[model samples]
Target: MSALSESRNPGATRSLQVVATAGHVDHGKSALILRLTGMDPDRLAEEKRRGLTIDLGFAWTALPSGQEIGFVDVPGHERFVRNMLAGVGPVRLVLFVVAADEGWKPQSEEHLQIVDVLGAHGAVVALTKRDLVDEPAIQARTLEVRGRLEDTRLAGSAIVACSASTGEGMEQLIGALDHMVGNAPRPDSTGRPRLFVDRVFTIKGAGTVVTGTLTGGPIAVGQEAEVLPPGHRARIRGLQTHKRSLEVAQPVSRVAVNLTGLPTSELERGDVLGLPGQWRGTSVFEAWVRPVRGLDHPLTHRGAYKLYAGSAERDARIRFHGASELRTGERAFARITVSRPVVLDLGDSFVLREAGRQQTVAGGEVLDTDPPARPGPDPAARLRARIGLDRATLACRTVIDRGAIRTPEIAVLAGVTPEEVAAHGAVRLEGWLVAPDVLQGAAGELSAALRAYHSKHPLRPGFEVSEARVLLGQHHRVLSDPGLAEAVLGSLAASGAIVREGAVVRLPEHRASTTGREDADRLVAAVEGGEPTPPTVRELVAAGFGPELIRAVCADGRLVRISQEIVIGPTMLARAEHLVRAHGAPPGLTVSGFREALGTSRKYALPILEFFDASGLTRRQGDVRLLRAR
Candidate 1:
């Protein structure tokens, strides 16, 4: 037998298929499994004593073609329907059992509806108790089962009559199952592993153990994992499949994970186990739903509904789009909000059951995990655009929907890896993924803001950096966050949309101009005439000279800025520097002596000396100033 081995590691198995069993109570599903695998699937003592399958049992067998198949034996009693849904939710194939004498029963129809909703990949019907019926009765039961399955995902399934008690036709049933397993398509491995825990128990020295069908990818022993809802970290101490210890467990197979750092009381059934930061729980999502074929009334928002997905079930409320209720056989997009958060992704299938009546109501396919808080009119248009898209495209679309998003946020919202999101063609600004249209719109708004800034303060060099950030935040809400706003500015600067200086931002073509302007000439003349102690900024603003014009003349070198409130002509600044150099060498120039040399008062001299000190032209020690060495 050829073991399904990973190419990277020659001795390691890469693939294992799991098939779940479904049928009516006491229909010989468990007995048939024992006959085929020679191992009893019923484990609980109460179940064995009652002679009815309860909870979930698991077994495995190797096929003739070296393919290993694991079986999840689900209870068929009406009372244990929740257990059955949990077993079959993540699985894609089934071995449907039906008693030949009873034909189709109540639980059989309900289970079949679930299988159809889940879109089972392939199936084989085991018509059990064949020894109790004649050849004619066997033919009639086969026809009835086939007719019922004609409209389901298991329509083309092969039905083989068998009796687990008498071991009649067991060989033929095994061959039929082997053929079905050999041709089944492989499960998707998206590099994000999620195991919806179905059972949590603790062994003496091993600590907590959780069992479920692992999907999405492979999980290795000793890997770091996380349990959701409580959202705590746990390490995988060991892994097993069908009682055989494995270094790594592949997707779409039954797995028992021994986890450390979490108690059994904290981790329960319906919780999720996954790699840290790879999964996010959401309480509300949007999906496309269809009611069952024979619903007695219209499916409305006012019902006690429970949603089943993967292995988790939560109380849910449904609100249809463009309508208040959904009629039978009709499909519509709807928003489903659950009482508790669940980890779901796009294209995931879920079953909705009316809890009061204990009957299945509708089934749905998830379209969006993180939907808008208020869906505007005709929201279905947005969902329709998302149909049939791959993960990368969907991640890119998420960026478009939100205007700009970080890579980590894209991974969480779109259910893809960071690497996958990075590989897309969208514009990447720093750590944020930006859609092309959004980037273009931001560029246009920034350009317009810069133009307006230049027009309002014509003499200034540029708009202030702090003010530019405010404008960007106002235009794009996504950039309101700390680092994201800077990323947008950087991208704009790099693309020549604007130029960013130390304290200001401006259009590339903008420059501070004092040429042929009456107001600029007047401001420069006023600062030049004020000599050593010029009119302060407050005085200039009070004297009908705009502060922007005062700063502009200073920025253009027509006037020198000695302090926030003090400005002087370039000639005055040069004179002050020379007077300080001549004030001479060592124990430094005292403030009083320099004030006398510059022919200025103490207030003007102090600010000039401090400005020189700040500009690296001089160093101050106590009240003395020393000229810096050239």
Candidate 2:
């Protein structure tokens, strides 16, 4: 009977999970898996002759608990660390193998570090070769391994001593697997499937077959897919999960795809097959880097490094921002300029290896998938907000940050064209698409600032355009840019949350003060209420009120402004509209004809007539003005 049967069911069918084995060369990771599942992970003849795993080996078994588990047996030699990384990238658990006789090893530490960087957090530390070591030695070695894991993602991992030769503690290891598998996270169904090709080979009659751990979403048989970077289209002719034929393979599970489109020679390691339209490979991206564990040195700026993300490894350079060098144990922002295009999602974890060093210097996650060549200053701070915000909110914040971003930049943020962004409920001003919520947030900001200003100076009616820009910039850096701030203000005005008059902005509730209000009332009284010609700004300013107050009255909708000087109150505007309606026809009233009809100077009447034409209330033909349908 398979040793897997020695483990008992927890009473129900359990979760499916993948776990990788990592340790030093010839430390019995393969033998241990062989003992546990009765299947040899080492499939290569070269590895069989050399007695070492030269490549990743796959095996699986069903525990008595009915939990189906897959194992990716990774080569433990330092030379195959990249191969090891590919196996460990998508696994939910790491079965960290530390031989009891061999004790702690360097390659084991490297494997754990890669696991941490890729965020495959949970681990089970196996003290293998227990039969070769006495109890005291086994306990000491187990404690040493535990000490190595302190303050890490695997800090709380269960440690079990097991020997493939004598089977000592094998059941305990399987029991631990049963207990932990239930807590492993299921695959994300974000509707975008990604299978980073780790192995590519041809099958008897199945054509080209590629295998990797599936993630992000599901890949079903007969699904249309594309190989990224190369961007060759394909159709999934067949699907296999854990060696069993499947109609659809879910994420976090190992999958082998039979594809039709490109030949087997065209595929290679590090190629990604995904749902085509949702993603594109980019050569440049931004990442927020943090130093590796126990690395007590700063990272050099503009240094070339080897970066491993998913199943792809590429040559990359770090362009550190705000610092010449990144100090050890400190977080820094940097742009990852890759030699090859890679399909990366925002927040995907990656490991960075120094060019000439044996140790990995740092690791980070992609912060921006397609960042501008020069990300604006304080990019890390801006990116952090986006991590928690929805795409539209981030797009809006991007506009706020840099005043305005162009269509291409908007495409980077919104994942669509600026026109598409607007079509999907976002607001567009000029050429910039604004987050619908941003408009409200900006209005609230303007309203709040105006409210504060009113509280400080009750006599002031509103914020002058220049003053409003200052206050907006003070409220949010994005608001400080005149173009974007005006866009926000313009949106607010359109929504009627604030009033925009001449060169001033204010909340709808704000009004000119006690003296200014009474004087504006008296100025309107002096204008003939039923006449076409009205009092001018010069007359109002000479009477008592200032030009500023008169402008404020016009902005607050108390008066109709005809020109710089010619103005009329709402009562007189009603009489002038009455005269236009009295001649409302196809060949309406001409400027001179209206002037003669109103018995007024052309200076006042002409501006009023022009205002009517411009307002869409009347359409003029040569010298005639026709009233538009109400």
Clashes of each: 0, 3
Task: Estimate TM-scores for all models.
Answer: 0.80, 0.66
TM-score of model 1 vs. true structure: 0.80
Residue 339, model 2: Cα distance from true site in angstroms: 1.0
lDDT of each: 0.85, 0.76
Residue 4 displacement in candidate 2 (angstroms): 27
As for model 2, its CA RMSD to the true structure in angstroms is 12.6
Per-residue C-alpha lDDT of model 1 across residues 131-192, encoded as one tens digit per residue: 99999999999999999998778997999999999988988998898899888887887888
Q: Compute the lDDT of residue 458 as modeled in candidate 1.
A: 66
For every candidate in turn, the CA RMSD to the true structure comes to: 11.7, 12.6
Which segments of model 2 are wrong by more than 4 Å? 1-15, 386-433, 436-630
lDDT of 2 at 255: 80
